[model samples]
Target: MEALIPTPADCEVRSVIKIFNAQSIVPIEIHRQLCRVYGPNVMSKQMVCRWCRQFSAGRQSVHDEKRNGQPSIITDDLVELVREHIMENHRVTIAELSSHVPQISCSLLHEIVMEHLLFRKLCARWVPKQLTPEHKTNAGIVFLHDNARPHTAQRTASLLQEFSWEVFNHPPYSPDLAPSDFHLFLHLKKFLSGERQHFENDREAEMVVTQWFQSQAADFYDTGIQKLVPRYDKCLNFGWDYVEK
Candidate 1:
């Protein structure tokens, strides 16, 4: 008759003991050698070899040098400059940002703006032209963002709290989770670009955007506008760079 296999709980305890006390009673390697010399035994079914090795840990994680990261070549002032341009001009490219804010590498600027300053917090909210069942859900009905500097300001969050509207920011690079980037921005961009003739200045541009949003029909908003979500996803998948013209 075949020997019954040991239960997982028993196997686990035996495995730990094997690692703790490496000698006597047929150490795993000795068992293997015995199997070769004296042939396989019914008791070999409870071999704790693999589990012992796992528990015998000598830094099981991937080995890599903990080299210091690249030197920080970006400044807070530079990140703040990028934020100001974004607030005023609506967009900027890497090249344009480099031009506007000198004394920083493009890559470093990208890193700092994204990592340290959290420049996305500087912009206005992508106000939904029309709310739907889709707009009904958020992390909280009235919440505030975490991460102090790059998130919504305390005063701004307090204002939103009065109206009891949910406020949240997903983790960085989490484009899939945010609805506004996938919906509101696309609709707003299309509307603004279509009425380009009306925008002679930044103020004019913002006003035109507001007017276009206000003018959206319920059917157009509910149907055609929803398609922007997929396009926004595509843009994120392809590239999230903001190109300045």
Candidate 2:
């Protein structure tokens, strides 16, 4: 019989076997070896350690242990089915998606949309979580968010007055006027979509958000703010009528 070549996963199992026999080599050392051959991004350090621990506990199976669930009916085919509808129209609603993929429950479809495809609904429009404080020191600073009591409080108004930061009037039922609603958040949501990274806490999320902001070129933000002008023009033209742009 011809000798069989080992797959990457097979090599990982073999490495684990070697580490077990040696009774001394740590996971970090094996990780270094794998990195030398496959590059650093091949697998996470956490996964390597997990495999090592499993091997130590006499769990010889290289394959994943069977997970307890509804047997994971969400296959790649199902994911592609959902993805096609989303790609055709990024703003497609969950209810609309359910129509196309009737087999998938609303909640499972929601997980596929938010966690797998990296999309979120903002004012009924599908977008990415792409916010950044890049232009903080710029002469013009406009804060636009939903009208809430705390936001309109006297203390908040005083703070804005002190900083000379203008608060754009986000009228009732008008998401188009807000740059965040129509532009910033839409862009942000897209940027974060389909990304596999996860944050353990608020501090990590903040750090990642800040890092994403720092990575953007100045024009990215300039274009977002500039879009507000045309929206403002539309609002004026309609005499403050509900403009859905």
Candidate 3:
């Protein structure tokens, strides 16, 4: 059975152990469950016990800790090489970059790009900055929000009037027309879920969310806002009924 079945990575096995351990499953039971699916050679009982103990002690990451004597893949020359590739084509993907620099893993490459070089993906393209100048100015910016209590409050109305900003009328309970509800929140939820992020405090969560927003390209926001036109048309044509996607 072990010969026919392909082996899973150590990290993969660790992830399974972590999940089961979180549910208070004993190490022996976890190993038994894993053996049933991945064959007996999946992991040793002792290994499962060790990981369960680690998680119980508050270890969050599944990846192995960096061990001494392992040579670092990231070097000045490699950093320069990555920089050259990004400079040549800002749209280059991690997969494409890996083909050019096959010596390093994609995860390591991502670390180099994000942490070492301070580059991030914006609208599917790697960029150094958000590159949205329109945000720097409030000129011709139309503010649109729902008629929530706080939003429709006298203070809010006075603030908008004070700024001389054009406030677009939004009907009640019209989430379809709200860019945040229909678009931003959807992507935000996916990003949060995919990362399985656990924040220690509100500050950490806020920092992560702010970084996410800053990483987005101008076109990402523009695209979301642009959809409001068609959405508005739909709402009006449907006699202001709930616009279901």
Candidate 4:
């Protein structure tokens, strides 16, 4: 008797388990290029080629997507938009972003945020002087959060307070908790592909994103909260050095 043969997901996860067991990031361009150039035929030692074949050929149980781009579609404004939506509405998705940005395909919005944006593939953090740790700690923590800042600057603090009741921030390199990493964006990939649908314009995209966000778990904020505690801890323990790449 032989061991039960697993599905494509089993195989893919196994392969990734092997590589990521060691833990590494493969540039998607290199992976996609190998499969695109050599794919329609033949085989090789390239693990990426194998991965591309398994995924693109429908051999894998996981959804197969063919992505090709040396650069990303995300800009500072797009990040700002995603951050704004998540901060205000409690969820953000490709459909929502279509209004903010219409040039991309729905799949791109879904996958691109994970492959590119969340990983800082094209964008970098723009830490404002006001958002720093020192500024944060100086503000009497709770007062800094709700009571203190509003007393100092009622208007500015009020606007911020509206967003904070729902917003949760994750630490750098903590991909597992970020909405783009954990569920929202990935769910969009399954949705757009499974439904064979794509939004044609910004208005349509906004409707889609808004609808998708509404479908998420009420406790969805917990994901970021759990991850952020460690991040905040690391910040306290190491300050600047503890939490950086």
Q: Which candidate achieves the best TM-score against the true structure? A: 3
Stretch of 10 with least lDDT, candidate 3: 130-139
Please provide, for model 4 over 1-245, each residue's C-alpha lDDT reduced to its tens digit, 9 standing for 90 to 100. 22233233434433452353234444354444334543422222233434544444445343233447755555433444454443333345557767766776777665555543342211122122122232243222221121233333767656657755322343343334333444456667787788887789999978987887788785564453344444445554553243432
- Give the 10-residue window scoring lowest on summed lDDT in candidate 2: 130-139
Superposition error at 213 for model 4 (Å): 1.2
Best by lDDT: 3
Superposed Cα deviation of residue 172, candidate 3 (Å): 3.2
Give lDDT for model 1: 0.48
Per-residue lDDT value at 67 in model 4 = 40
Instruction: Tell me the tens digit of each residue's lDDT in model 1 across 1-245.
Output: 23234333434344434544354433555455434443454224223333334335532322122436874445333454565554344346667778877777788767765664444322223233344342344213534233445456777767787877766443344334343444556668776577667646899777866877788776754664445444444545556533111
Order by lDDT, highest first: 3, 2, 1, 4
**2 or 4, which is superior by TM-score?**
2
lDDT tens string, model 2, 26-137? Answer: 8777767666666665545444655666677676656544558757766544665686677567679899999999997999999888876566664345543432231242
User: Each prediction's TM-score against the native?
Assistant: 0.27, 0.38, 0.43, 0.25
lDDT of 1 at 95: 72
Better of 2 and 3 by TM-score: 3
- The lDDT per prediction is 0.48, 0.65, 0.77, 0.44
Error of 4 at 88 (Å): 27
User: Model 3: per-residue lDDT, tens digit, 1-245?
Assistant: 55334587767778899999999999999988888878977766655776787899899988756647976767544665786688677689999999999999999999889987777764345655322332243124458888889989999999999998867767665657888878898899999999999999999999999999999997889778767666876777777778876
Candidate 2 wrong stretches, greater than 4 Å: 1-146, 239-241
